[model samples]
Target chain A: MNVFVLFKKEAKEQVKTYRLLIVAAVFLLFGLSTPLLFKFLPEILEMSGEGIPIEIPAFTPSDALKSYVNSLGQIGVLVAVLVAMGAIAQERERGTIIMTLSKPVGFGEFAVAKLAALVVTFLIGVALGALACFYYTTVLLGSVDVQAFLAINLLIALYFVVCLSITLMYSAFFKSQLAAGALALVTLLVMGIVSSIPPLAPYMPSALMGWGQSLAVEGGGSAWPALIISGAIIVAAVLAAWQVLSRKEL
Target chain B: MTEAIVCKGLSKRYGRLLALDNLDLHVEEKTIFGFLGPNGAGKTSALRILAGLSRATSGKAWVAGEEARLNSSVLQRRLGYLPEDPAFYNWMSANEYLTFVGELFKLPSAELAARRAELLALVDLAGAASRRIGGYSRGMKQRLGIAQALMNRPAVLLLDEPCSALDPIGRLEVLETLVKLKEQKTTVFMSSHILADVERVCDVVAVIDKGKLIVQAGVEELRQRFAHPVFELEFDQPADSAIPLLQKVPGVTRVVTENRAGGVPVLRVHVTDTAKARHGLLHAVETSNLALRRYEIVLPSLEEVFVELVANHKEQSR
Candidate 1:
């Protein structure tokens, strides 16, 4: 119960600090960018008012949500990785870890609370951006199924959580805040690289993003197995980090 | 007397170095016990072991009548420790820090609030409770450390060199507070090399050297046992035959004279008993007409006692 209360307190503090501003900015950027890109593409092709043979696809509210997912599944998650990389690592850098560990709450609960904070931020950011992008895209194009769009938004949120969890584990391992942040960015870059290759692409975590994005765009074709597998990997990685942490001296 | 803490052959190794070497201790409840030692003398290690911050490599400890390893939670609830040079969450205010610790100990909301207020005032940080700890001075931070340690109103308080970082005024104020706790019958265990602080606050004292306890006894008793008092005399003129003459006296074990600066003579007379020896030496001084310039009793200080004990140990080992 105390751990839960501490978790809530930490959550509130996290929101007050740059988390809210960062989430809002990213969401707003995605919300405005999605509709503008869809609305102006045909006009841009007509620049110099020349005859262009290519035709733009029928824009819909669903397209906007899909666009946002692709953006977030890549850029949005990358931003989150940067913001959360030092979440635990900064504590160790500033030596607050010793101060906090002196308290009675076990280390697992402490780590769990921090991970929960990142997940909450991800949910709020993705949810707000999805809602905005839906409105603007609908006005520009036409109405679409809200359920499908929201489903895609939820997937983006979960993907963000998965990304944040990995960085949190790295933050727990590294002593320096800079190392944690750098390693997180490097790890994500390596994921992107490995998944882009021809032979090894299917086995990489980046493939999850690409695969999940396509399913989200097609509306309801996505199976739950890949998401569940990623969730399992997150749990296992966090557990391994926690085990190493349990034996670490202050 | 109720024993609050009992350790048997406790030891802890850090790589090749032994921080604690088969240390044993028995502390009585409701008493102020001072652990006196120089730096790197394993005082911190012993305190950490009791507080569950560090594990012991061998032997066992009973804290509050429970095995330290077996009942750490129950023991931790009772033992409040403030480490030497404690680092706090600089971003948090004193009130928030205390609240965090209080919640960790599972105090109810009302209880935590009230205790936080009381401890802040007790440590003279009431006005600064809302200010960030990063801005606090070294003395203020040390006080906050003590306040956080006392949040649970623990039964056994272990302060590791709590006054070491403090300025003179801060040290005096903290020493006064510690002594007040002693009067309240709190079982307080504090470690320091400052004998004056220990003498001012603790009723029982333990002298530690090289990770070993040199002596542990009541303050007055240890003074009586290990520390020897002697009377020294200096004269303008050296007594030509005073050594043999002084040795012939009933109480005098030996008489020695050595040259001091300015070619003056100094007398060192060791006797079996301080009071009886001073009496006989004074008598000899008067009868000999030795042109005495100064006569003073060199009652060994705690530092002197400490140095002598350590020196004797080294000599015996060599």
Candidate 2:
């Protein structure tokens, strides 16, 4: 119940600080433009091809959705880190944490509330982006499988959650937003690199992005291990953040 | 009276510099207790430990019968704390912030609303309660801080430099609110370097220097115990010649010369024996041929007592 109250305040803060609007706007921009860019790829290539004859294949709905997933996977991760890097760091820096923590609120509740709010923000943004991408893909390219597209978006959202939670953990570790953001980015980059290795790909949270891409292009085996591991990572990150804030001097 | 707050050998160390050095304190219930110290004197550190905002490196503390430690919800619920520089979500209005704080304590909707209104009115911020805190001045923010700290009607209130950012009128308003809190049987432990405010509102004051407790006593008791009587003498002419004569007077421990505005020479004589010093000072002035315009014995201010105490403590430690 205390967590709910704190979550409400955190949600309100996200909206008032324009974090919700900014994240939604960035996602929608990518969502709408991904399909459009693909539909016009041949023309764009020919225009820049300097009159050289270019062989181009017709675009498919799968192609458009896959491109959208990739765009969101890369750009969305950056947005997630940037948005969450200041979650706890700025609060500590501004000394607002002292006032809030001096109440009947637990440190775990505080940390969990922050992650929950950010998750909701990213979920809304991802849903909007997915709807935009689906609508445009149906009109410009061929009709796509709605179930597959939804599943793909769910996977992408989970991947972004992993990013947000990791960044939020670092936010609790450092008082400087720049340091937190840099370390979180580096950590994600390392995870991305590890996901490319065949042996480790199934266990890495970054593999969820691969699962989404494959789901868009073709029905394939599920990355259940990656899915389970992603959930664990998020839980661990939130707990780590709570522990850091509990021990912090602010 | 029962003790609302107690610290047994509470010590905090930052690197090699000990901010609080085996400090012990006891604050009685329903009183405005002032924690007095100079800058970097571990006053904030002690208050933070009591507030459960920071942990002490060693020793133990209890507030309202609950052990004080970082992130103890039970302890937090029993007390309200306002940091030296209280910060809030700047994007939020004072009304929204207060509501949020009330919700943290799970105050009922109707009761929370009433308490919010009452506290805002108490701090004189009801007129601008809906305004964003970012737009507030420092004094306004300080007032809002006090309002939020009272949202739960906590049994004990810990405030660090509560009036440091307030204007003279704002300080008076806050001090008055503190006095009223005392009337309501709430113990308020406030740490401040502003001796005048503490002297005005505090029933008991504990002075600490360099992380060590120097003295603790009631206001009048502190004045009487640590303060010496001072004699102020105003003369029409220069009293430079009288300094030597005054120093030779019996019971005169120290003689300080001052030039009042427009260059009127005055002498302040700090004495151990007020009766003997008074008579000898007058005789010394007569012998020096200085025309004495005024002679009065003035009780020492808290400022004087504080300086003298800290100086003596430092001297003794050396």
TM-score of each: 0.81, 0.96
True A-B contacts kept by model 2: 0.95
The segments of candidate 1 whose C-alpha lies over 4 angstroms from its true place after superposition are: A37-67, A186-208, B230-295, B310-318
Off by over 4 Å in 2: A46-53, B237-245, B248-250, B257-266
For A1-250, candidate 2 gives per-residue lDDT tens digits of 4999999999999999999999999999988998899899999999999999999999898888888888888899999999999999999999998899888888899899999999999999998888888898898887988888889999999999999999999999999999999999999999989988999999999788888889888856589999999999999999999899877777
Fraction of native Cα contacts kept in each candidate?
A: 0.26, 0.95
Give the least accurate 10-residue stretch of model 2 chain B, judged by summed lDDT.
Answer: B257-266
Model 2: lDDT equals: 0.92
Predicted candidate 1 versus true structure: per-residue lDDT over A1-250, tens digit per residue: 3568668767766765667678867887897788878888778877845775666676665566667767877788778878788878887776666555655656677778888877877777777787778787878867756776666666667667777888888888888767877787887777777667877665555555555556546654653555676788679757866765676644
Accuracy of chain B in candidate 2 (TM-score): 0.94
Give the worst 10-residue stretch by lDDT in candidate 1 chain B: B66-75
RMSD of each: 5.9, 1.8
